[model samples]
Target: MPQSTPSVVTIGELLWDMLPDGKKPGGAPANFVYHAACNGVAATAVTAVGNDDLGRELVSLLSDNGVNVSAEVNDYPTGITSVSLDANGVPEYDVVRGVAWDHIAFTDEVRGLVEQADAICYGSIAAREPQGTRDAIYAMIDAARADAVRFFDINIRSGFVDKEVISRFLDGATILKINDEELPVVARLFGIDMPDESISGQQEVMRELRDRFGLDVIILTAGAAYSIVMGHDETSILPTPKVEVADTVGAGDSFSGAFLAYLLRGYDLATAHRRAVEVSAFVCTCSGAWPAYSDALKEEQA
Candidate 1:
């Protein structure tokens, strides 16, 4: 076997968000891969696209951003979601179904590439379709277990995720990320407490999740407030930096990508946490999910 490369592999849907102005390439996996590349982590996105114009444009966009799309399929029409922005510029999505991403067929090359990765990032939303793509994701997870750290960003979209799929992904995950609201839902699914007060209570909730799921790291984001990072023995709170918001479209995904990028680079949890905050804040300053970075913004920490 060839030597394994220090790269992150993100697997999920790749599609365009039909915004009020036009279409923008946006999906959880694609957004995460974009930030991973921006942070200087060699990253590839394993996803499927359609054989249509939207798919071609998405491929071109990924190429221009230096994200590898070699494992991307073009068998069906590209996936698309309609975005309706609220007064505060937050987007509510109406995701279209039966797109190419719903039937993602994994090739031998995709399996090989995943096996060579240092980390793999996936989410529950992508696993909630057609059953074939979900199986493909599981196959990659099983094959990459020895070499890759599986980071499960449990992006539970309504009408998509169910209890069984979330439980299965958690069983295979090394690290997990979820928002404050989703935490309670997941805890209830696992029959844990529905807390009402205090960050300590929240920490306990997270600790229970880690202990039950065998998680090495658990990240919980409380929007516009502090985020919590919990390990087996340590727990720390990192504050979200105040910044002018363009949109909150991919802030969570960017945070997950940056955190993984820093951790894989051998940074301590505190350092990684800080880096995640900074990178996420920078992303929120721009309109798109994955914002273009300047050289200064991409500077590596010593």
Candidate 2:
């Protein structure tokens, strides 16, 4: 059954991040679901896992973190990613393919949750790999309520992204979040290579994406340089807050979650943007993605 309050749904992969030291649960959408729940949103994860030990552990971790996840069990093995970190704690992932989440078939449970969701989050990877769940992923995206915020996180991983997949995701997305690295990739895919001034170039790129994709809001994140939120005849450039370093594995996902959670809770866009930046910076100071929300982070939670 759906909850009484509005729900935020993350529709994508749930798998283990096999770190150099040990393993932890960390997929982009899973990280978003975890951080959204931590920041006081009614969060649900709509993805699949294999009927295996790894799958069981992933479910237990989600439940323990206060996320609602009764994922469908697949016959394949659970997804896993091997991670290695740089000196600055930036992580590189060898994300596995042909895992369980790559085949999320349409079901009543996914349909019910999505139909009632206020915001539905999805990544482009769900369409790239294996190509089995591509139809099912599109079906779930179509199932969202008409007023729901269809947030498309262009989480480009490895070489999985393609022009067709990116265009397909943009067809119905209300909001877009892209990092500096991926911005160039998007431009190249769209056949744009214009050179302009620093700020103007960024704004123009954002506007191009907005106009091309019919996005209501465009969030451009430049790690440690600045973050730009463009919408409604205004552009806000917020400098990335400096913080003590931890691995930046899930910082971007946290930003996406916090921004949407604040909006779902009725805060203004500017405030929500600020909160997202702050929360993401805080996450960078912690060890992992789903850090406990302590006195350090100030979210207007229930």
Candidate 3:
């Protein structure tokens, strides 16, 4: 018998990444949904796009990749981020503001989707936008089932962040994902000390966040270096598997997606961490986040 797929609903921006070569569909929430689906979970994306070519293509690409879309068509033009990669395939983004996703209005449809989700993924970028978008996200969170896992990927971009906003989101998040740099920034904001010279201090930082936010799990990442996972029972720090370079656009989001999917599917933290690191490394070997997932490539890496 075919097993049921764990359902994950990701809410936030969906847009094109206008890379130097051309454009591809990309956004943190969209990347999370795509990789979650790749991890054998039933994933859906709740975001917005203009009713234009870019929007249509974005939706079609997501659907083709096996992610369900609950996107709203808005009057603003579709969102896009101009991307340029450094020599090491690390990318810098100039995100376009005031797009369709900026105006994602609250609706019964989004609420219903959240209510049905086993895990709901969101990012700081959405709430950093218009008041309406933040309100819409809060409403969806409110409608989620009591036990639904609220995964917050702390994707801070530009000046689109503040301590108050992050704190408010933490009140609802069951899981938190942040990069190495953001960890110290967050620590300082909450009066948690982060000692650079000590690994135990780092763990303390993670534990403080976990306890402070009442989070079930915490994932801290360092690009192409390592990642740390702290939980109620155990904590593990895993080095990123080596891989040939490509533009690292959605690598972090891919990690979050895979970790959540594997965890929901009953994998232990260590096992899930390995898979998450593997998947994220694979993403670094591809040009974009929503790359054409290759079974052969995955097996070869394995």
The top-ranked prediction according to TM-score is 3
Q: Model 3, 105-221: lDDT tens per residue?
A: 768888778888899988889887658688887887787898999999997787776888888788889999999878888888888878772557778898989998799999999
* Clash totals in order: 1, 0, 0
- The prediction achieving the highest lDDT against the true structure is 3
Summarize candidate 2's per-residue lDDT along 1-302 as a digit string, tens digits: 13345579887889999887788788999999898887668899988999999999999999998899958898989999999999999999898988899988778888888898899998887777646667776887789888899999898887877787788788879999998888888888898764653767877888888998889999989988888888868777899898888888899999999888877877778888888898899889877777787775743443
Candidate 1's C-alpha runs over 4 A off are: 1-5, 71-74, 300-302
TM-score per candidate, chains pooled: 0.94, 0.94, 0.95
Better of 2 and 3 by lDDT: 3
Which 10 consecutive positions of candidate 3 have the poorest summed lDDT? 293-302
- What shift in Å separates residue 260 of candidate 1 from its native position after superposition? 0.4
Better of 1 and 2 by lDDT: 2
TM-score-sorted candidate list, best first: 3, 2, 1
Clashing pairs in model 1?
50-76
